[model samples]
Target: MDGSLKEEQILMSSERDWTDLPPNLIHLISQKLPDLRYFIRCGAVCKRWFSSILLSDPPPQQLPWLIEYDEQFPRASPLKEELPFYSFVTGETGSIPIQESHRGKVYHRTGHSYLLVIDGEVISLFNPLTNEEISLPQLPSRFDFIWPVFGGADPSRNWPWHISLVCDVGRSRYLTYYLDRMRWQCFDTVLHKTCNWDGMLFTTEDHGTSTLVFDAASRKELYTIPPLNEETFGFITSYFVESCGELLRVSLDYNLTRNIETYIFLIYKLNFEGGKGQPHWVKVSNIRDQIIFLDHLTGFAVRATAGLKGNCIYFFIEEHCRSDRFYNDSTLWRYDIATGTCEPVPCPFNRCSWFVPNLR
Candidate 1:
């Protein structure tokens, strides 16, 4: 009789309506969600739950979503109609719809949550998470290839957002756009890689032998930091990322010969107040409580939460092997900064970009 009574109570509780829960309790539960996807799903349970989630604070740290371009899609289909985002935490894929005006456009690059898309001569910034689109003025002439670098936003400046468009012809040229001004300015210098830090734009040339700093507000070159004379035998790629109120540069050296490939990673932090009041690179072995996400083009850093790992780099490697013919293989890898070790992580897409989703 006691067992039967307990069973009946359990059945009644299982059938209870979850929507009747107190809003404060629901908000607390929403705050405990592991990631953004779960938080979004929790809001979909009911209208009351959605209201509670809106009042709750999201997770402080978030892992970036991998946005991939589907090669299997029909060539005539609009590429920007929908984007597939893969989550590392859940190991699941989800689709986010693009705005109707952004359809049929091609994206040149991605920075954080924003996509730099081009339609004919017009360029626009689209945020898939928020469904916000801002169109820029048309370019003077359309280029065959465009490599765009986002300088983020500075509310203190006259123009808040800064974008640099590098036209790849025989020689590289830069075209900068100011958001508030709604105009473009052409620069004659050639830049290899660019990143934004503390309201300034940093550019590298000649394989990062030197770094040029440009004031995003004034549109003038501030100063240049001398190169670090490091010798290695393979192709070197450098990435600049800001983390923990400081700027860092991560360099990857790799050699592909025959069927074997070797990779080495080195990290350096920029010290603004060094000896004699000049900025210089300081070699760093560990970056505590921070995670870095990198691709071939750009990279960014984020704080690590309980669900994420810190002092490591999450990047992908595209391998080409020539056995009978030529074939390509892509794999995601995690490199530990302290141990100098690398391990492979499973990824569904061969080519993807790291997108940090934001509700704002």
Candidate 2:
């Protein structure tokens, strides 16, 4: 062939019709792509390419796969930085910025799309997707409101559209609030006697406890956990991780022996659908090395960091001394249950009381 003709053939080959490729070959290109944008670019090459990529089996496993440690890995000087938030998919850090700090502050994360925030007496439901927030009725602070815990039906399930909060005051009083209903109801449970301000409202897929919602107008604990016999208490703390479709509760007992204090970590699976509570809890970790639960991390023990894929629980381990609270330098570590390993991830902030993963 002529030299000019040969050069033209090479150019045509570079622009070969993407439709000529098989579906599997197109899928390989999508998976092998390093980032989401690149995968998207591949789909834009041609109509057939886009259709094949989208229709390919196993769909694109685009849910955040890798944990992106912000400039803040091996987070040291805990108090110096606020909790770090990031997007696992974009490898972005501190994605959500709090322009105006509210009075009640954010309690628990509902999903990657929404967060439950308390402002004064009212509850603010913030949606990251719409970038808009709605205000709910003021909660009875005296009753001691429960944190909002959320989960979906499954990976194929719809995004969570509602939330529940269970409030308890003193003893023999309980209340439950459902966000969808925008109302409060009263129920009685065996736990009425065992319930305390520190006693948390538990939920899971099977036999889980419902959130106690408080009525500011009634000024009473109205909701109660049924079949309370299934409910057990020792040291209870709950948190939801968006990266993994699961809610985690760390229960432990701390007792002092011979002037030494010890801590144990027990994990519980939350049953959100069946409203059934699990009788047995799973033990995750235990540190007997003269460690005391710092008063700061008493209620909310575990937090999920943003920008990571998979089930990794970020715990703020406080080093306490008999003289006073362990403030100076705190260590943040990631406990990866899948790998059964705990390693320190770096953070860029200081004096971080809690970690809010960036939801971008």
Best by lDDT: 1
Residues 1-360 of candidate 2 have per-residue lDDT tens digits of 899999999998889564799988888776665445456568788898889867864323233222222333222111112333433335455433343443225344242234555544666666432346767667645344343433332222242333445555546454545443455433334232111121233332112344442333343654542422223333233332221333334433222221112333345443444545433333334321111111122222222222343344455543432214422242444555455454545543332333222222
Error in Å for residue 57 of model 1: 5.1
The residue-by-residue lDDT of candidate 1 on 56-146, one tens digit each, is 7665546788888556431111356688888887889998887786677777656566777777766776777777777777777776656
The local lDDT score (0 to 100) that residue 173 gets in candidate 1 is 55
For model 2, give the 10-residue run with minimal summed lDDT.
Answer: 288-297
Q: Score each candidate by Cα lDDT.
A: 0.69, 0.40
Which clashing pairs does model 1 show? none
| Model 1 residue 342 CA deviation in Å | 1.8
Alpha-carbon RMSD of each model: 4.0, 10.9
TM-score of each: 0.83, 0.43
Give residue 275's error in model 1 in angstroms.
Answer: 9.9
